[model samples]
Target: MAKIEFAWELGAHTGHVTTMLPVAAALKARGHEVRFLLREPHAAADLEGAAEIPREGAPIWSGPTINANPLNLGEILLNFGYHEAGPVKALIDAWREQLRASQAVIANVAPAAHLAARTLGIPSFEVSQGFHVPPPAMPAAPLRDWEPAPRARLEAADRRVLNSINQALAAFRGNPLTTIGDLFAGRSMLLTYPELDVYPERGPSDYYGITKSAEGKLVPDWPVGDGPRVFVYLYHYYKGLASLADALARQRCSTLALCRGVDSDIKGRHHGGSVYFAEEPMSVSRVLPQADIVICHASHQMTAQALLAGKPLLLLPTQLEQFLITRRVVRYGAGLGIAPEVNNPDYTSALTALAEGSEYASKAREFSDRYARHERGAALATMIARIEAALG
Candidate 1:
């Protein structure tokens, strides 16, 4: 059996680590030796059996924290800048060592990892949980060469971010400067949202069929009740859903709110007759199957699992991309999307429709049936096989 080393360069919460760990386990089941290189303070403890290779020891370098929060625009921009300098160089240094030992490397869509893998002449694959399409073809309005200087300034700032990323990549690989679009063009393998839930109109890629395993075993004794229950996933960074637990409680629906790393000051305010606050990662698969409806941001994993459970969703998406993903759900007749800034809008009306609407429930059931027909472990098995073949 081939010895395969997999690096989960960043692991903040359970979701970020989901893509690699399942594939690693499947490889082990297939009689291959698999090692996991992870960052410290992992959120998921189940990964203990896999050899823990620290970021400092791994051949590919990674930042101390993983940036997965979609709403932190300022943090995103700052991270883009920070990665351009220190982490990118460190990764190049690490990749040089990895090339002497390993046959290939795989990374998430982080540009620094891509650059390092390229520099070492190692085949790298990009795995993710979102769509990676080119920006939609929209009509470009002519920029006034003189007026509207603010718009031009914004454009220049955007270009600088892209330039910073490109320069770092080119510096390490000794290649001419290329646009961010060019760097992503046809270089890395793309594993994104599984095709079963995503629209079929989108073009196929090398790794589009990968599906995440259900987390049912995590919470075998999930709570159930007589009344209609709603499960809400609240991220500390996204404040749009701050009042959601209370709202569900006020409606007299049984509720469980999973708060991920929220501050102590903000906890337990939503307590009422029917609502409950759960700080731990509750088994979403168990909660989702019995949920009358789900309220969340456009977290693809949670949203996808809810759909697979035949539960209609009400998405309070906080970003442009999330809004777009929610739109896909609406287009597919599976869920509803609420703009984060629109607080006065009637979320109750949407939730009411989701819980009682026959059309919405039918669509959700259809999606669940379709997803169930596929072989459950095919995607993870395929990824392990590909990595083993690459090692060979």
Candidate 2:
């Protein structure tokens, strides 16, 4: 059996790890030796069995706002140390050593890994959400709705990062990348998000759809309730969540919230109320099947789950990535987006409308049915076939 390596050097959340798990597991099940190169090993404890390549350093991007200049994408990678000759050389050496015996590498938003793989003459592919991959050609207006950065500003930024990357890549005799989008370019790309959420300029193939999180298996028993069930899943923390939780508690509906950073002291105040907080990880798959409507941070995983289950969403997105997904949900008429503020009347109004109306529910169900028509695991199968062919 051919050995395969999966590399992830970017992204700070469990989404990067979870996004790759299913394909890795499926490869193992097929009798191939699958390994991982991870930045956060502790978070990926379940992947302990796989051989590892250590990763270091922090992500460069921060905050809820995004600068959608095509060149800003390259700058983010360069700032993260990819343009440093010492670091790039060290990474190349590590990848060459680990992947020397492997047949192929599949990277998830890990540009360094892709570069290293390319340098070693090993075939590689990328897997990720659509927004992560910039389009081949920079659009006049890169970001939808938002004004584009000035051409001169974008050109200056792109030139600086591109020159640095080329200089660093030169040390290993790697081909020069012409644009930030080239970093993500490959013979094949497997997108984990739907077309509706993809950047307007991209033409990615059929999305594999959101893979079910393994945590979905270990969710605790669902709370016993007959009232309209609301499942609130956030990114561990959000601004003004206490008030939002309070609003949910007072809504006269059964609310179950799974938020990681919320302490029991805060939860205790709402203990006897209709709202329940789970300090531990809960099975979204188990709970999503029963939710009447999902309140989330517009996470693709949860949003896809809610849509797939025919449940509308009340999205409170705090960051650009989540915000983009939220906009798509609204565009599809399957959900409403709310500002990340506490006690906003719009929040309650939207929730009341979603809870009391069937139009959103019907649209969500229709979208779900359409999405479900795509073969869930076919993309992985195609990827595996390509890997096997490349090795041969």
Candidate 3:
């Protein structure tokens, strides 16, 4: 049996943790020894069966815990960039000691994980839920296709931030390349999003099209309301749904806003006739199955769960990259995409059309059926088999 070490940098949110946990559990069931290294204190609860590697001395950043809203800009940027080097290095040092006897390391997309695994001279597997990062062959692209001079300038600033991040990872790993992909030769990346869901399939050899199963934390207990109940999920640390919340309330709909932390500033904002206030984050599996429609900002967990539950979506994507991805979902008949800048005048009207429409629901249901037939367990099992073979 192979000794597998799974490492992650984020812990509070359950989406990614949940994704890798089941895989680790499956490996253990198959006679493989599994160890997990987490970088967050909040992630300890999620690491029930696995060994918990504390990050108290690690150079990891523990920024304010907030919903995945645009208001939490600092946390989002820190997450995207490995700027908090102290905590990361500390965590890596601890992991190095813990993994000294392990056969293989499964690193999440975090650049630090990659560097640590390399430093330990172990093969690393990159598991991702988002778009396959731009290969070293391609430079960072604009998040949106059509932006003016000012927006273009802003995007350039964002690119600089990412470039510095690349440089930091390279410096830490003693590599000069500006991209993470350049550092890992012969590394395999498993893309969990289904091929049919992504735009213009490039069909990369290493990209595996695996559909993840629906696993949610809370049970669905949507209150019986007078009108159509709209569920809006804001789980991102960089994007906000205040405008969408306002628009939903203005349209006279009963809205359930699922937020993560104690940010009461945006609560009680009226969209049109709809009342907007912060509600606790609910399990998409339990909530999406009962909602008439879902509104979100292109979170993979929320979007994937919504699609699986066969619920139509109204995506209000703020990031240019997210906008492009979510636009595909709308084009594919899975949902509607509302540009982040749309004002109250037009926002309510667009949302009304989506909520009243049935086409999106039909298409989402069809995709869910196809995905369910593919079976998440089989795909994960195959991945475990491959990992075992690689260890040998």
Best candidate, lDDT-wise? 2
lDDT of 3 by residue, 287-314 (tens): 6667778887775656777777778788
TM-score per prediction, in order, is: 0.72, 0.85, 0.68
Off by over 4 Å in 3: 1-3, 9-14, 28-36, 43-98, 136-144, 147-180, 183-186, 194-201, 204-217, 235-257, 262-283, 318-321, 341-347
> Which of 2 and 3 is ahead in TM-score?
2
Which ranking of candidates, highest TM-score first?
2, 1, 3
Residue-level lDDT of model 1, residues 179-208, one tens digit each, is: 333444554434444433232343554544
List CA RMSD, all candidates.
6.1, 3.9, 6.7
Candidate 2, poorest ten consecutive residues by summed lDDT: 58-67
In order, the Cα lDDT scores of the candidates are 0.56, 0.68, 0.57
Q: Which candidate is the best by TM-score?
A: 2
- For residue 183, model 1's alpha carbon misses the true position, in angstroms, by 4.2
TM-score of decoy 2 = 0.85
